[model samples]
Target: MGQGPSVIDQATFKEMGLLSWAIIDLAINWGGWAVSAALQTDKFYDMLGTGSFLTLALGSMAAAKVSHARKYLVSAMVALWAVRLGAFLVARVWKVGHDSRFDEAKKQPFKFWIFWTMQAAWVFITLSPLLLLNTASAGGPARIVWSDGVGVALYAIGLIIEATADAQKFAFKMDPANKGRFIDTGLWSYSRFPNYFGEMTLWWGIFITCTSGLSGAQFVSVASPLFVMALLFFVSGIPLQDAQAKRRWGDIPEYQEYRKRTNLLVPVPKSLFCGASCGPKSQ
Candidate 1:
């Protein structure tokens, strides 16, 4: 019988694959960074993130000759998410004229560079599952499994939650009566940061989808969801938004009351989780 492939060969392939992907991340993010920093503008910063996701997903599929239905499934989910979120951000930024998040950061060289690099890291880590899936040695098409169905269902639920919340918020903002008011109705009533929750949920769905094709070390791609959770909970997403919310609505009694009652991430009703506090205030 012929000898099995050496451990050295496998390790080499893995390192090379990761290096290639890193190169792609840098090319997209840093390249965009150079332009944005030079122009002193952030109009396209969010687009860069989405563009990186789409570029790498499709490009990796092409590069690897990925014909497996499982791989295509992963790529398609990524494409759908990247496009939807990207379009929303682009439109919102255009309407608002500028992103408050980048106001000072874009002016400082180190801060701006960190923004791009961190974004690259975010893209690489978030796309790890799909990247690993597509780059793996293909064994032809795969049959749809229970896991795939579950993944698709979770993805659908998350996407709907995120899209609906965004649309609802947009409508509320458009109403002249809501000029200075915070959104506390619809999905916002369920969770203070339902969009973030939805974002995390959808990524977990992608991770689960990739599991059908992942094994051994490849399973480390679970970092996709974990990194997102950490970013939102600890690092960037929730913390920044929460701070901004506090600055804007902290002094309002209604906002403070809502904050005290609302779940921070999950959409569970306060009444379900709280006993007496969730009850209506006494007159």
Candidate 2:
């Protein structure tokens, strides 16, 4: 298949306050990385996702002469999730180069600038919860308790499912024999977008961890996971991919049959009667 053509171009970054705020936030996040690396907390860093958490920890450690427990936990989770997502996107961008969808949106000069600026703003907005949550944790001593255990379990499960789903899709697409073929095996068979399901659930797990204290700052953390889930399921993730799928397979009877038998986001065991029973022509 031809690489999708760019529909937008000539976009430049705008000097907006929102953009400035986002940059400042990201810079603070970098500081977190510096201290985290120095402290040899690579595993913790990986789990937290963003440098922001580390930054929060560093700042907290400085003021209090000891780490605030809540800050440590929330920052760690935020950093882990952000890093995982950022790495995944970076890899994807490397493989495909500049995202065509983004390129297309940048075609009009004024619109291009706006789009680029919004991209920056979005980064800050989406991550604001983590940043806020981290600061909130710095206030006083907090205890890690049973809720923490539950949250950790949920996070672990979510990560496993999401990672497995992504791996399955990647492997399926890599095989030359599978070219132009729909995947209906492994995790793919379980849910149309198992990765997305896992993604939403993962954030909720993080949210659970952040909210264990039931503080006002913890309330702010709620937005991070909820916003991400909405963005993934509705605004950016599923809608875009589903549009492509419809474009590719809308007219195919086999796709229609598969659609009938499978859930969109939840995994269901493939029925023996449903699979072999579909005639060869449909396959």
Name the top lDDT candidate: 1
Q: For model 2, what is the error of residue 273's alpha carbon versus the real structure, in angstroms, after optimal superposition?
A: 18
lDDT of 2 by residue, 16-80 (tens): 22333455555544443445445423222222234443344334333332345665665566556
Candidate with top TM-score is 1
Cα displacement (angstroms), candidate 2, residue 41, comes to 34
- Model 2 lDDT at residue 7: 21
**Which runs in model 2 stand beyond 4 Å of their true positions?**
1-23, 26-66, 106-122, 137-141, 217-220, 270-283
Native-to-model Cα distance after best TM-score fit, residue 12 in candidate 1, in Å: 16
Task: Report per-prediction Cα RMSD to one decimal.
Answer: 5.7, 13.5
Global fold similarity of model 1 (TM-score): 0.90
lDDT tens digits, residues 1-283, model 1? Answer: 2435666555554444766987988899999899999988999799999999998887676656446888877898999999999999899989889998899988987799899999999999999988888888872338888888888888888888888888889889879999989999999998999998899899989888888888889888998999999999999889998998999999999999999889987777877888788888899
Stretches of candidate 1 exceeding 4 Å from the true structure:
1-16, 139-141, 275-277, 280-283
Estimate the overall C-alpha local distance difference test score of candidate 1.
Answer: 0.86
